[model samples]
Target: MALAFDEYGRPFIILKEQERKSRLRGLDAQKANIAAGRAVARILRTSLGPKGMDKMLQSPDGDVIISTFSFFLSFSLANDGATILEQMDVDNQIAKLMVELSRSQDYEIGDGTTGVVVMAGSLLEQAEKLLERGIHPLRVAEGYEVASRIAFDHLEKISQKFEFGPDNIEPLVQTCMTTLSSKIVNRCKRALAEIAVKAVLAVADLERKDVNLDLIKVEGKVGGKLEDTELIYGIAVDKDMSHPQMPKRIEDAKIAILTCPFEPPKPKTKHKVDIDTVEKFQTLREQERKYFDDMVQKCKDVGATLVICQWGFDDEANHLLMHRNLPAVRWVGGVELELIAIATGGRIVPRFQELSPEKLGKAGIVREKSFGTTKDRMLYIEQCANSRAVTIFIRGGNKMMIEETKRSLHDALCVARNLIRNNSIVYGGGSAEISCSVAVEAAADRHPGVEQYAIRSFAEALDAIPLALAENSGLPPIDTLTAVKAQQIKENNPFCGIDCNDVGTNDMKEQNVFETLIGKQQQILLATQVVKMILKIDDVISPSEY
Candidate 1:
């Protein structure tokens, strides 16, 4: 009370107190959120490739559930712990950022969600050191940015040209295996590559003015005899209906193809269907009917007898085709389609007619002329497509194992597809567009120039693989990042998908610039964000300290 202070001094004291409290609260919440995020990441780190293990979670209600690495990450982040952090008045922005980071990290590495968390944890520890050393957050962030640039440069230097021709695909496959633990990668790569090639061939055949199943042959021995001719034609895109007892043999059929899932449309709302909506629905139904009719016609034109659509037809559509005397079966998903295609000799498309019990026992149909070893079929498939094949198989002894296997398979497929279709430009997982704000932010982080901004703009391009895998693998949006990374390591071999001899050629250089530039941008943005996040954590402290 005896001390007198100037007006400026009084204002300074008040501002200092407010700032100190704000920092304290922010730091406390940030630490908690970061810890939770790191923990979630750690749980799924080992579940990266097809060879990655499964995880089991038991609910409080005595329910035992099993899931893959990606699923686990999603579950953990969306679990009660994350909710508690939010409830504790954790900064929503930071919490949400961590959640997204977790998702992105999981998607980027497939099995490295845990690794990312650990990395983040390490970063946090390092940040603490920086703080102790009295390093300002700004300086730390700047240093990290420099370090990230170096890391990205290293990644680029290490990146080999992605090749896809038959001559060097094995080495490419081996490269993917370098960081993985599963033998399924080679098996799946061969199988899927073969399937894609066969599918392409089948489509090419159908597109031919002359549709002929006679041109296709069943190759291989099952139960000791030469395989019978059961031609599978196009991609089965449908599901089978759950109905009255169909033939046991039909039900027992190991491989059938349909154009759509068999599940009926969900019940509609009680509100009366509008005439316009009804008309549109009716038009779609008519189009579907015509499509099937044309498909049957094509089958007849091609002299195909056993046909399956990966997609499903309506009851009327099914009846119409069945009445037309075409032997057919339908499968619900692409997984089932692949199984059917493999059973039918590599043909992704099914021929006309339902498969008889006797025919089902024989190799259902042969998509390609190759047989025996999976490698041979894969080679044949690749040759047919003029592209390369890479498969990632997940093997486990339990349900968790199977789930993880499927997730790995889906990721590998996406990587391979991107390499083949888009020349290996890294796109967002699931077609998510990078927001304009994010792009701007990313550009600003680079040199303050338009060229750098344009170069960084590619970061906004959405990658469809992760999203597709997440949707297909049953993981939520939160877990996609982990799954993506796992898959990337398993499938990313620049030299794997490209023709090695063609390297340094003008054509190669052009393709390289186009492909690698986008990849570089993606790498840059990811690295930058990671470093920025680390810097932001410098001020964080344990809640217990408060």
Candidate 2:
């Protein structure tokens, strides 16, 4: 703050976010905040629908990434909302709120990251007009809260129940395909959607209707074609035998999951050892050999055919284990080790004394598969004792394709899991938004206050989604939305949406476009919450950098 005097020599203070010259207050502050938020929202607006463009994001370190994306916020071929926000290097506080807005949608819903931001941005744009007309920001925020509730309730009213069972999974596959259609791997959406549905079902508990996504692993590799992607009923570790001479395959393997290294334990604190005398050196070497022998003996005495260690193997101990005819894989990560344990129904043996037959994990067959001319080998443990833990091993010609496929599959998998949890769904391609817009607009007449203006603006903001969808799909935005809106009214159909794919119909239900009910509700609620908070911030203050 800096002191200033009026013409009457009265003193007052000026508050600025940065330098003294950049003073902001009241309407100006709200406008600045709204603009900041809209800037972030505008970045994601183009990436809204299935025909949305991908963003190519490049980092300062020269890494190019095109990831899970949409709403046209391409950082690097990415249309995913959460990815673009997380990768964005924005300094604006309100813009950062937009990032958080995207993150909340991703965290709860796992999809529609781009759509959420676009929705929030449109809300802010509408609020800006209300503020310009002298409507209070608080009144605008309250109006939005009401509009959001109306939209949310209308979503539930229009949402349809999707049926699926172990024997009936086609509906789930169709829903997942809708998510994948907007992704970079749309051509293979059918196959990927089937794989995603199967993977979710394999890990999902039908009785509880809850899926522990941790039980499912999505492992990607740069090889073969995208069609080569398949679901494994067991764990697949990107590792091979410690030694080439070791057996490459084992049948009916009794596996040992170990945390301890092959070498003798070292002191936790710093220490030194002296071996000036040859006899002392020989004694020390003998002691080390004895330790290695005991560790190997403990593993073998327990009837373990395969060893997967959390730590790397010692060269001497590795040679000893190979010679002793025990196949071992070393340097496994902790999470992967746990997944392996879950997959094989094995206990992790942290010490040699813990080695027992009951502690072992059983697998029908464990084999090493090599890919590419580079001899990149991965260990495949198939037909496990516990068939619940599975992996979707993805193969693609390039890393970017694999990464994008991973994003696409992730969206599909989340949609499948969501359906299992709450089978209620709404039609996609902006059908839900259009329906909500109509509902909220109809409800606006019920209120007789200045907030009605803001409420009407909220209704208009809801149209931004269908507008973005139609615009991205190369259709005349206003004309297409107007036509669809007319159809929805004439037919009394809530499922009429933009024909983004030009599938010859504006009816998303007939087109089989699906989105989770809870997910759509979440998008509107989160966007409104963020926009309201942004509007309430009529001032931005930061410590002056020295």
- The top-ranked prediction according to TM-score is 2
TM-score for each predicted model, relative to the true structure: 0.43, 0.92
lDDT of 1 by residue, 403-424 (tens): 4334433333333333333233
Per-model CA lDDT versus the true structure: 0.37, 0.87
Can you write out model 2's per-residue Cα lDDT over 112-177, one digit (the tens) per residue? 888889989999999988898888999999999999999989998998896798889988998898
lDDT at position 511, candidate 2 = 94
Estimate candidate 1's alpha-carbon lDDT, on a 0 to 1 scale: 0.37
Model 1: residues with Cα > 4 Å off, grouped in runs:
1-23, 26-56, 65-96, 105-114, 162-164, 182-324, 328-401, 415-528, 537-546
